[model samples]
Target: GIQVEQSPPDLILQEGANSTLRCNFSDSVNNLQWFHQNPWGQLINLFYIPSGTKQNGRLSATTVATERYSLLYISSSQTTDSGVYFCAVGGATGTYKYIFGTGTRLKVLA
Candidate 1:
């Protein structure tokens, strides 16, 4: 079994600000995914960063399996970025189900 933890349970960002969210895992993971759970509770997949870094628009993610941690970077924060960011990890021998971290909730004030 794997354990996940997220830092900064809550965040407040003014429009145009930047922030970094972190996730730490207890064990090695074969799969790592970043998700943004909108205010409506819909989960939007941000990235599947098993390794390296990736960016899409104002959002980016990086995962270091050897260190057992991942990071989500949000730049130029907007009202749309207001939501809960979650990091999910899947390991071998498991059901392939993702184990999510507590999440970092962001509030972007317009």
Candidate 2:
């Protein structure tokens, strides 16, 4: 079994601030993703960064599989971005499933 973790368990920011969140895993994995869980408890996949880096608008992510870690960055944060961010990892263990991190809670104030 693999263990996943998200740093800075909680975050509070102004509408325009910037932040970087991190995820650390204890074992090798075939897949890894970053997600945003909104107030309504909906999970939105942000990145499928099994490796390398990706950027979409003000959000970006990087996964270093060799190092067993990933990072999610947010620029000019917004209220819409206020939510719980999570890192989930999956492996080829005969079943398709994801082990999610505890999550990083972000609050973007107006």
> Cα RMSD for candidate 2?
1.2
Off by over 4 Å in 1: 93-95
Residues 22-105 of candidate 2 have per-residue lDDT tens digits of: 999988888999999999999999999889999999999999999999999999999999999999999746647789999999
Q: Write the per-residue lDDT of candidate 1 for residues 1-110, one digit (tens) a residue.
A: 79999998999999999999999999888899999999999999999998899999999999988999999999999999999999999985556777999999999999
lDDT at residue 10 of model 2 (Cα atoms):
96
Off by over 4 Å in 2: 92-95
Clash pairs detected, candidate 2:
none
Candidate 1 backbone collisions, by pair: none
Candidate 2, residue 80: lDDT: 99
Q: Cα deviation of 84 in candidate 1 (Å)? A: 0.6
TM-scores for every predicted model: 0.95, 0.94
